[model samples]
Target chain A: MSTATLNVTTVKADFPLLGREVNGHPIVYLDSGATSQKPRQVLDALDRYYEEINANIHRGAYLIAEKATTAVEDSRAALAGFVGASAAEEIVFTKNATESINLVAHSWGRTNLSEGDVILLTTLEHHANIVPWQQLAAERGVVIRWIPLDDDGRLDLTDLDQLLDGVRLVAVSAASNVLGTLPPVRRIADAAHAVGALCLVDASQWVPHYPTNVADWDCDFMVFTGHKMCGPTGIGLLWGRRHLLDAMPPFMGGGSMIQNVTFEGFTPADVPTRFEAGTQPIAEIVGLRAAVDYLNAIGMEAIRQHELDLTAYAMRTLTERFGDDLAIHGPHDLENRGGTLSLAYRGIHPHDLSQVLDQHGICVRAGHHCAKPLMKVLGVNATARASLYLYNDESDVDALADGLAAAGDFFAF
Target chain B: MAGLEDLYREVILDHYRSPRNRGELETPPAIMAEGFNPLCGDEIQVYLLVEDGVIAEIRIGGQGCSISQSSASMMSAAVLGRTPDGAREVLRSFKEMMSIHEHGLDGEPISTDDQPGASGLGDLEALRGVVKFPVRIKCATLGWNTLDQVLDQTGT
Candidate 1:
């Protein structure tokens, strides 16, 4: 399933945004890590769902309502299958990855965590994974510990046993959005289970780029977003073990999540419906199903290989062209990294550099990347980040290099 | 290349490399205000030494992008010797020059050199190109906004 057999140009053509121009030049979109451009397949799914099957799911007995309900439930099943979940009932749809984590924090954290309990997390987590726990910890008087990062920006796992002691939950990102360093999720999950702690993996960055198997990773809970994987926004997924989800209380109280409601109290529904409180994003779930189908058609292994090749080529080209003037954060090797290149060029502010690059129609993210804690740890305010996807190729990387060289020339003293 | 030159003029880079009033004022009766752009992690602190309703001394301290730091430096140079009202006028003029509104000066069919209130802009006119880059406008005006906060705090 290597990308050598995959025609990269045809893949690029699938995304309509890739064909557009900006600022009188062809657009080189390298910000897929922030949000991926949707392919026509996913877009068509949304359009068809609205035009043909627009109805409120789960309540109405009309034909269109039944069709809409089938579409939404079928999407859950397909998404569960894509992530290798044991059953579709274990998949819970939410607004986005942020709400997915917050659901766990509010429901599971409020129930399980108490005073003197500790929740361990890694430094590479986005604010989404960090702030929820911090809020829960503040309310419950619980302690929070961190897994430090080594100089190369990979998680320092040498003291995993010590950090896991007295820990009730361990949350970590499978891949750092800032550094592109893929932490060993399987090892971390095994260690957390050995310590009798439930492990949660933030797969927002990992599931979009790599071959993800919740069963293989053996994590207790996992979450990822649809928009980052060529689907529409306003839809995400949370997959947990059936037993854990059943035991946890409902995160939000509403109509769809309850089985029986009295004037006094309510009895919650089963595992997934217990979490989906209100009406879900029906069209987005359908679009997400189409996105999953598109990825499966291309194959995750091929996508990973293509991104690795592009990453290797970008690292070499940028290093050769800029020399010491360009410094890329994270691991130098592509073995444990993805196609995200966070670069610092000769004291040029990332905002300034990104503005210069934008003039050439090269889009790159220049900010803390929602990982301000990681920014403080790395001793930088921000890095100009150029992230690649399956649609990107070596020419896009070359265009990035040329834009950076122009930045140098423009800002040269 | 022409647009790039317009945005990062030699005067802006010169101020970035060797900033004017690039320190804190130890004198008393000075008001300090800090501005931060959480998006890009740009932070700038402005200190003003106001006496008799005039900014007798001004100093800026922070770390940020070239546009921000250079704008702060040029802002210090522009308003150092002006009274409180005069400094506010300078701030308003700079904002006008950097404004990207539909009916404001940025939208007018006029050259950057002949822009209204060009005489009041002095070296601050180097930032006129920021109007073309909408996202970077915050970087160019972070210092001016902070100084406005400082002035408001002084109640003058």
Candidate 2:
């Protein structure tokens, strides 16, 4: 908050994992797209939670149990604020983003959707968003339509009106994990609403890198994971509109989600509680609160600005260094994309490139990035992705370029 | 710490550069089967031409990283003239070569008797370096697994 830009050195110091070495070399972690390294603040929060206030939340009545309940609610409120949601009860914590999406498909889709109804999705969706809808379609005989991608890898929304016709729900990713293309989420939400359809944005990649305001986007539902945002794993967020969640049934039924059980019929709790069953991820929620605090301390605007500069540097460096030998997928417009770079080295396989980079202690993900449909659009089975976060700086990008050069030489025929 | 030279042996790179018996064969006479490493989107297809008890001919199809493609090329070359039982022998030996070092990775002692070269699998022996990188073990075995599936499907 004090500074306009994030000091990469100070931010890097906050994360303990970056201080560690791999294979006798300093680690250049560029795989933030998969999962981010935890900051000491978040780790300390976890330690504090387990040591001081480990108990079942939402049901316990004693001192430590009450403290645990308060901690979980406080984290929910923090997450609601982080995503620009007015009500804390709108946030339902799931295992991760995949589970969050599934909760929506099962609770909302199962209750509201029927046979022949259409769910419009884009090629940019991760398997989490795509498969849930496909599962719903299989069960209900619902039809699924696709929003194609253009040559620039952004959504081709030329036939938006036609695609929205008869569509009950529209699900799409805010920023593509593979291509880093930031679709027009607000415009899509507006169009879907015009046709009396609901919109859900899978912001798993977008929320960490950008300033998010759910109210501004006006989407019915949104989802993101914790570990990807420097929080602990095993916790995720699903923020829904009050009206939508009010009508939907509970996703999972158990002790915490029930109001009363009479051994005959049971009454389910309200909204978020109705979805979160069993003992909640108390320690993970505490860690998530700390992660949100850390991000707030640095400020999201500063983080986005940092990544914008770093991404430009990375694109220029890779092009100058590898020339036509390497092709980086996604939009060239700086404002339309995030810092994630999905690379295809002309002759070298992504798996081999990843292996070679690993030897040099450069961490990158080599896979379809859980967006197999996007990979098909890019004409690649898999890609080596190097994504940037607030902790990343220009030197990490330089290290990646150098490591790639070494890989080229090592794999040379 | 598996060195690049270990995984990318000259022979493995050679096979990857110029794969032997590449592309698919006729599926009617040559039974075709596919294997997938879902983690990396690595898919390998094996087409087998069986005659009596012999694996008369073989072709490797599909695409993946070096460990997968080169292993397929090497497997095709090694098992071309051998009977199905003899090919399974090489498959078992290759599988063993890739699995032997996994125990060493977990700090368990690996016997000196099971050296990669001790198997004497010829060009296929070069893939032993794959075990040092545990995640890549699947890539190295993708070809062998697909071939084994096809050989068994035909009851050869």
Candidate 3:
């Protein structure tokens, strides 16, 4: 309901990399699904942390150490508030979203899951969400079932009762990185709860685009990364329900994640601290806080509105231009999707299409996009994906269309 | 655009359009090797029929981008009459041609045991332009790599 619209020009200018040229033309990056380009504000925040507050956190009596610890805690709290978590202590920092899921699969999966227990996943999950569970299933004799997709790429939950029967955990992605289908997470969570199952939301795609509320979704666990949302790399956030997180064992053992150590045995720390081992990524965490502040100032609802509107415009433009020749995969309903568009044009090989686009300085990811299973489901080897973020506008989409037209001419029989 | 043209020459395009020897032979009579480029999920399979120490027949399979598919076509045509050792020699020369820098053997541009037509690799020379676009170098070499693997399996 927020009427605050983003000024595309101003937002575009804030990203330093968007101004640079590639191959004698202005760069038009549409690969935010892979990783978003950081804005100047987020970039400056990293520099400021290194210059002013560079110190190892959590174990220092010195002034800079205290400051760094405070910064790290503040980032945790900010991220918690951003996602509507009850307490900052529930958020554990890890290397990336993949590591976050692995942390849960290794720690929580080992303790909670037994042989013959079922972990239900979706066909739309990225390999990060899928592989960890597979590893868990391999180690423990857990049977995995998939919630299949409909013809239009949305999750078909007609048999939810049967699918959730005796399921211990339901791990699903909030959005499909390839198809851009926003799965009905809240409904799925409710169904999962009805079956006495734990629900873990892989929000690596959804958190960056939409307004996220863990309590509203009623998910037991959620995980996402920083780099996709304008923060620096080497940092990811994992939020778990307080009781579950407290009960779960530590994932990695090292210098700092312990309360006490003995020759015989060792005692680990509590909650988030128990999970964060070794020297933490203080600067990147600080950068993440700055990124949250930036998004908060703009407001996530407004950002969502901008992207949704842009996605609609793009669909219309591309369809109008190419008609039957171009195919944009995913749901026809714009209300239930994000700004990611996986394009297939006139049967051009994705690699060829990607190469042609690069010459025009239009960067689109041309591969299986770490979702090889999804690729098989789509019945294509690969796709050229043009994903939009807060900074992208109609001009970027126009440039993509023009580039595709040029590719058509180049590959003409 | 000029760089793209160099990467996708007319011969490369023709080979992609109507690929030569695009199939497989029986298992006992032929050896098959498959290659996959993890970067783009494109795959290729090369089947070789060795008779009298020479490749009596060659066929290509799978699908990929222009560079990968066309390179396979050109490779199938090139190694038709050559011995397994001769095919390996051609692979070395083809890889050398596709390398961005002259990856000489111990500070030398050419290896000590060199073939006569290493520089002039016939139809395979169209792939030399792939060096300009470094990423597509993998695509161009997918066929040669598969053939090399199949030959290694054959042990001939």
Candidate 1 whole-model C-alpha lDDT, 0 to 1 = 0.90
Indicate the worst ten consecutive residues by lDDT in candidate 3 chain A: A1-10
Q: Tens digits of per-residue lDDT for model 3 on A1-413?
A: 56798888988888999999999889999999999999899999999989998999987899998999999999999999999999999999988999999999999999999999999999999999999999999999998999989999999999888988779999999988998999999999999998899999999988888899999999999999999998899899999999998998989999888999999988999988899999988899999999999888888998999999999999999999999999999897997788989999998999999899999999999999988888889998899999999999999999999999999999987
Query: What does the lDDT read for residue A214 in candidate 1?
Result: 96
lDDT of each: 0.90, 0.91, 0.90
What digit string (tens of lDDT, one per residue) describes model 1 on residues B58-140? 99998899889999999999998898899999999888777643134345554655654545687887787766666778899
Prediction 2 global C-alpha lDDT: 0.91
Model 1, residue A49: distance off in Å is 0.9
Best by DockQ: 2
Between candidates 1 and 3, name the one with more favorable TM-score.
Answer: 3
The docking quality of candidate 1, as DockQ, is: 0.58
A263-323: candidate 1 lDDT, tens digit per residue? 9989999888899998989999999999999998998998888888889999999999989
Please provide, for model 2 over B56-104, each residue's C-alpha lDDT reduced to its tens digit, 9 standing for 90 to 100: 8899999899999999999999999888899999999888777777767
Query: How far out, in Å, is residue A295 in model 1?
Result: 0.4
Q: Candidate 2 — which pairs collide?
A: none
Model 2 ranges off by over 4 Å: A1-3, B112-117
State residue A214's C-alpha deviation in candidate 1, in Å.
1.0
For model 2, report DockQ.
0.82
- Chain A, model 1: TM: 0.99
